[model samples]
Target: MAYSEKVIEHYTNPRNVGSFAKGEDNVGTGVVGAPECGDVMKLQLKINPENGVIEDAKFKTFGCGSAIASSSYVTELVKGKHIEEAMTIKNTVIVKELNLPPVKIHCSVLAEDAIKAAITDWKSHQTPASAQEPRKAQES
Candidate 1:
């Protein structure tokens, strides 16, 4: 299938296409695969702990042009966004922005899932006291 100009552009020059050092405390890494299509995606994010802003994002995807474009676009989209704001970015938005055809929509979904997985990993790494203190205060 033909790709949209945006997809072609992103695929041609994929952004943030590398990984952080292994065991980097500030970095969160997410890896996901599509068994049916044999696609694998690895996404990494570095976040500012104090304010929860995404400082950097990187992705390596093994799939079609749409998957690569989706991963690249998502990295651009999340950089500088607060974690909560980034979480609000839906797969449908990626699909629309990239002009992905219906058959290629799963690629966008994978991108969204990768983002969430990375964020979850980041959260998991945080100290429980630091991570839960704000929530406890809010509950009070």
Candidate 2:
């Protein structure tokens, strides 16, 4: 398969390659698979609690160059973005950014889903205790 120079570069010298410590509340990780291409991607993220911003991101994708590039690029895209902002990330953006071919576009979508899942998990955890409970007092 033909890959872009940038894709090759990233695949050879990928950034943020390792996983963060487990049970770390601020860290989010996503693993996705594509049956057609037999591609599997694992992307991780570290978000800042105070601001709910993505402080760092890493990936351990076991797929082709496009999958690797998508995850790598998403990690870089979300480095300084707040969860709300990051949630707005679209697969189209990734596709356009990488100029991904039609057959390889699914990989980019998986990368985007990974980011969304991480953000969603973070938002769910952020619900205040009061919001989680409706009754504050005991009934007599």
Error of 1 at 39 (Å): 0.6
RMSD, each candidate, Å? 6.2, 6.2
Worst 10 residues of 2 by lDDT: 131-140
lDDT of 1 at 77: 94
lDDT of 1 at 128: 66
Per-candidate TM-score against the hidden true structure = 0.89, 0.84
Candidate 2 residue lDDT tens string, 38-126: 88877777888787778999888888898998888888999999888888899999888878889889988888888887776555555
- In candidate 2, position 73 carries an lDDT of 86
Clashing residue pairs in candidate 1 are: none
lDDT of residue 17 for candidate 2 = 85
- In angstroms, the error of model 1 at 90 is 0.4
Candidate 2, clashing residue pairs?
none
